[model samples]
Target: MFQKIFRSYINSFSDLRREVWLLAFITFINRAGTMVIPFLSLYLTKSRGFSLEEVGWILTFFGLGSVAGSWVGGKLVDSIGHYKTMTASLLLSAVLFVLLQFPVSFWSICAGIFLVMLVADAFRPAVFVAISAYSKPENRTRSVTLIRLAINLGFSAGPAVGGLIIANSGYSGLFWVDGITCFLAGLLLLKLLHPKKAKENVKEVNLNPQAVLNDKPYLLFIGAMILFGFIFIQYFSTMPLYYSEVHLLPESDIGLLLGINGFLIFLLEMPLIKYMETKNSSALQNVILGTFLVAISFLVLNLTGWIGALLVGMLFMTIGEMIAFPFSNTFALKRAERGKQGSYMALYSIAFSISHIFGHNSGMQLIGEFGFNLTWYIMVFLGVVACALILWLIRILKKEAVSYSSTPIL
Candidate 1:
């Protein structure tokens, strides 16, 4: 029954092949491993005896490393091809995971985390770029949605399992399980993905690291994504801490909230994209609405006693996310130069890694002293700022649309 439903959904979309579906499966395994780290700040500071400030710094290092990875990963995709770059990244990341399991000095752990992030971050852009490359132009948004759906599904399951493991077996279990999953993901990539390397001249013609940054419209989109990412990243850091410390909620319930969050994505994302096609909304409009919803979701945390209120807020927040993400990718791809999609996508991803580190580290400090309520207030403010940027992007896009329409058709 499940297989039949899956086939039906795949058939509903154009240009989705067996290979893309297989790649999605591999991405799921890769992300499931990545999910283990979201709880690491809590583990390191609360359970493992690292100072809160130190944990924040370590997280920052990981983020900084990811920024570097995004740039290098883009070049690697052009040079070695997506399949090889992904395979190398996965294998190296698995090795780093094992290295992390050993008892090491704080500086050593920091260094290790940095290296791990550098390699692991490498796989993500290549994966997304490959999705864009393989997908038919008309079905591009749906392809991106499938990638996100895979990520959401992995994240949903991984955290519930991580929470249980942390509760029972501790941090060691999280590391071991995640490490194994990383290796498994690599093996899957090895067997399934065999993309040929770009020819030297074609690679040279298409991939330009500077092209992504220089394109005025694309840069505007990147700025919006960065701001949006900063606001969204608070969930991993500030939101969880709010539940655990400020609200004095049971840890299990926090896990349940995360589970609900993930489940909603798994169920709603692809369907939402399909429905949006019928509604005929512009991608920019969807992005604007989604950011607004995410901002408002933080307001619910102020209601201390009303769990139902919090749930309502989360539902709306998820709605915003479902609308925003797939369209964001589509917009970026649309603006990207022919053959330079990987470079643009990699640069776009850098925004997330950069914002996440900033949000998480800064959020830790805010939550520690000012309390969770104030943190949410701050996050709401950032969300507003992000919305303003998106509005500006809309204006820029309008001018571009008019200009393009005035041009001679091919």
Candidate 2:
């Protein structure tokens, strides 16, 4: 039975094109080196002696840069194609990451963080466009899930390794490693996905491509995603501080705890996405469910101070993430007409980037002023709001005669 189950799991990942696998592989390399952001707040407070509010302000700059980067990246993809945009963003961001290590003053670090992320996050929209280009429409959601699995797998390794690096060589080590891996990922992409080869693979058909701004249903969907992103980003920002301050966990333990989210997603998400696809469930329905689960995950943290509460909360959050993200991604890609994918994905990436602008800062400020319980409650409330938006969006899509099946809406 175990062997059969394992075979089934393996089968879920089969049938994807080679380019899709290559994309996933390079994403793993890049993300595996992403060790700094998770520990930024901790580094500021423990090492640099910044107050929580100060950390909030710094992260707010990070978000602003991300928002700009995503927008520019999207435009670049539409103009130059995903290949060049991704290559440049990766290489440029690598240099920025290394340069970021030297800034010591509060304002200097804030400027540095903003600059690094501006270049770094440009990769998001480009990669999304690349995924759409690389994968078949039928299995696109699974392809997204596959890339997410790579990201989670990298994340699972990054934090644990980051913790060890910090213990031995300090936070500066994270910057160097992150830079090196990003540079390597760029080189790999250049070598494997040459523009001439990529062009041969993609068959573009412009099907009455609607301007993203005028698509009311999609606009509402973006609004819902913004709320979802706001609540979800806390895991990377303030939640680590929660683990450190309230639970009194050391950095190594905190890294392991954070790693659990990625590990669970890597282990379970692909099979779960495959199962969901078979059910022919609407993406919005899954997103609604995911939003509610995330809300409950935060509420679980309030149930008790026991370490088990943290574990339970992490489990709930990870499941919510596994359910929501890929489907939401697939929905956005499907909603776009072929030629306009870059713009549509850029807006989607921007929604999350906008969340970064407010999500981290608000959580930090709230915790500093009101404590963790209140912040968690606020996140749950926001999650409920996000669900309502998605429900409204579902009604609009239904009115438009959009089918909820896996079929593309072109």
Candidate 3:
């Protein structure tokens, strides 16, 4: 039975094109080196002596930079192609990450964080465009899931390794590793995926090529995503602090706990996504279900102060993330016209960027002022709001005779 189950799981990943697998591998390499983000708030407070409020401000700057990066990256993909845009973003981001290690003062660190994210996040929209170019329409969501699987696999390793590196060599080590990986990922992409060849092979369909601004339903979907992102990003920005301050877990334990989130996604998400695809569930329905689960994950924390609650909460959060993100991505990609894909994806990436702007800073301030319980309640409330917005988006799409199911509207 176990062998059969394992084979079934393996089969879920089969049938994707070779380029899709290569993209997933590249994403894994890049994401594996993402050690700095999971530990950044801790580094600021424990090492640099920044107040919670100060960290909030710094993270807000990071969001602003992400917004800029997503916009520019989307435009660059439209004009220059995803290959060149991705290569430049990764190489430039590597340099910025290394430079960030030297900044110490409050403003300097804020500036440094902003600059680093600006370049790093440009990779988001460009990669989305690349995935669209690489995968068949029928398997697009699974392709996104495969890439997400790689990201989670990398994340599972990164935090545990980051904790060990911090224990031995300090936060400086994280910057160096992150920089090297970015550089290496860029080089690998350049060597394996030539721009001219990639452009020649891209299969274009007869999409509407409409301006993204004209798509009101999509804009509403973006609004819903922003709210969802606001709720979800709290796990990254403030939950680590919650683990440290309230639970009194050490950095190593915290890393392991965070690692569990990625581990769970790595193990379960692909099979789950494959199963969901078979059910022919609408993307908005899955998104609503995922949003509710995320809200409940936070509410679980309020049920008890026990360490087991944290484990339970993480499980819910991970499942919710696995359900929501790939569908959200597939929805955005499907909504775009062929020529306007970059603009559509950029706006999609920007929704999360906007969430980061408000999500991290507001979460930090809420915890600092009102405590963790209140913040969790607020997140739950926001999750409900996001669900309502998605429902509204669904109604609009239905009225327009647009399909938002496993099948693409086109």
Residue 235 in model 1: lDDT = 71
Candidate 3 lDDT over 235-280, as tens digits, reads: 9879999999999999999878887887788888999988988875
Q: After superposition, how far is residue 285 of candidate 2 from its true place, in Å?
A: 1.3
* Candidate 1 residue lDDT tens string, 1-410: 99987775655555675567788899899888875577877867776689977887887788888987887788798677777888999888887886776755788878878888889888877887777666665666788888888888787778778888888888888888888889999998888766642221122343334466567766777887887888787775568766776567798888778668778887767767876766656777778888888888887767556767667777878888888888887777666544466687788888888788677677778877888788788878878887788778777767766332122110
| Every candidate's lDDT | 0.75, 0.86, 0.87
- lDDT of prediction 3: 0.87
Give the TM-scores of the predictions, in the order they appear. Answer: 0.84, 0.88, 0.88
Query: Model 3 reaches what TM-score against the true structure?
Result: 0.88
Q: Weakest 10 consecutive residues, lDDT, candidate 3?
A: 401-410
lDDT of 2 by residue, 352-376 (tens): 8888787777888899999999999
Off by over 4 Å in 1: 1-15, 35-39, 42-49, 160-177, 196-210, 244-248, 300-306, 366-375, 401-410
Model 1, CA-based lDDT: 0.75
